[model samples]
Target: MVKEYILLIIGAVLVNNFVLSRILGICPFLGVSKRLDTAMGMGAAVIFVMTLSGFVTSWCDKYILVRYNLEYLRTIFFILVIAGLVQVVEVLLKRFSSTLYSALGIYLPLITTNCAVLGSAIICATEEEFMGRIFKSTVFCFASAVGFALALVLFSSVRERLELSKIPRSFQGPAIALVTAGILAMAFTGFAGLGS
Candidate 1:
């Protein structure tokens, strides 16, 4: 059981990264890749939202969706939950960490539609192992968020360097960034063999 949960965590984090393997949240990839600092901020915000939303969504799925035959409303319900949660988090952040909230506030609103967060919730809620395993679900969400942050930070750093480096006119900016992300994905694939 321990090994199985560990594999789930590893699988979500690297072997099946939200950004790399899953191809979610490309909007942020391109939009937030200009600076490492902003990327880090966005990543932190995502991690917080995804982790908390995952736990809530999982509980809803198990107790509400499954119990009430509301499975068909999964997408609608989960996305609403995520969006609502983000709003609450944003307000809390504003009240507490004004500076940090300023850094994340702009992105927090955008995270409502971030496919990666929704995907993590849906994946964790629906997975056989995570369905009933509350702890495992929480861990999986946290792992996925960490993987996203890692991928975003690396991409941002590479993009920063790419900006300074000379490149072919045809393969600059977005094109080069896409290629870089592909390479990052390939590298992360190596983690598949670990924790198994």
Candidate 2:
């Protein structure tokens, strides 16, 4: 059981990374990654939202959707849960850390639509291995969120350094960033079989 959980964490965080491997939440992965502090903030927000939503959505799936045979409503239900969670995060961030909140700006609100959060909830609720198991589902969600943070932080670090590097004018902005992201994604592919 312990080994199983470890593998699950490894799988989600490395092999099936939401940002790097699955390419789910490219919006913030790119937008908020311009600065290390903002990237860290976004990663923390995503971790909070995804983990809580996984817990809530897992229970909702088991006690509400699956119990009522309303699996068809999973997507809509999950979105509502995720959106609500994002709002909570936004409020807290606004109240406690105005600087970080302002840094996040539009990207903070965009967490509502971040497929990574939604995808984590949906996966927790639907995956046979996690269905009806709130703890396991939450663990998976947390692991996936950590993966997102890891990718975001690494990318942001690289981008920060890129700010000082001299590069061809043609590849100075988004062009170079996209190329770096591709390289990062390819590097992640090396972990593909580790969890298995």
Candidate 3:
């Protein structure tokens, strides 16, 4: 059980990383990664939301979706849950943490609808091995979020450096980012056997 949990964490975080391996959330990977500050903010927001949504969706999948035969509604249900959760968090941040709210202002809303967020929930729920070993919902959520944060922050740093490099005319902006992401993803391939 211990080995299983450890492998699951390692696999999810690196081998099957949201950005590098799965290629999820590429929009923000390119868009928010232009600046370290915004990228860090976005990464933090993703970590919070993904972690929260993972636990919520995992519970829903276990207690509601599977039991009620609503597995077909996974996509819609996960999206709704994530959106509502982000909205609630955003509201609370607005009232109490104005600086945080502003830092996360638009990104929060964007992540609310981010397919990557929804995808992580759905994937985590379906992976019986992951669901079975994930004793605490909070741990599952936090692990997923941490993995996402790790990928985003790493990509952001790479992109920040790429900005100062001399690239070709054709591969200037998004193209360059995409190529860089591909290389990063390739590098992450080394982690494939880590947790298996």
Judging by TM-score against the true structure, name the best candidate.
Answer: 1
User: Where does candidate 1 have its weakest 10-residue lDDT segment?
Assistant: 125-134
Tell how far residue 167 is off in model 2, in angstroms: 1.4
lDDT per model, in order? 0.86, 0.88, 0.78
lDDT of 1 by residue, 1-196 (tens): 8877778778887888889888988889779988999999999888888889888888888889989898889999999988888888888889999998987768888888688889888887776777766677888999999989888999999999999999999998788988898998898888776766
Give candidate 1's whole-model lDDT: 0.86
Task: Give the lDDT ranking, best first.
Answer: 2, 1, 3
Better of 1 and 2 by TM-score: 1
TM-score, candidate 3, is: 0.89
Candidate 3 segments exceeding 4 Å error: 131-138
TM-score (C-alpha) between model 2 and the true structure: 0.89
Of the pair 2 and 3, which is ahead by lDDT? 2
By lDDT, the best candidate is 2
lDDT of 3 by residue, 1-196 (tens): 6876676677677777877777777788777887778877888888778878877788878888888888899899888888888888888999999998887768888888786787778777776655633355446556666777787788888888988999989999888888888888889898778745
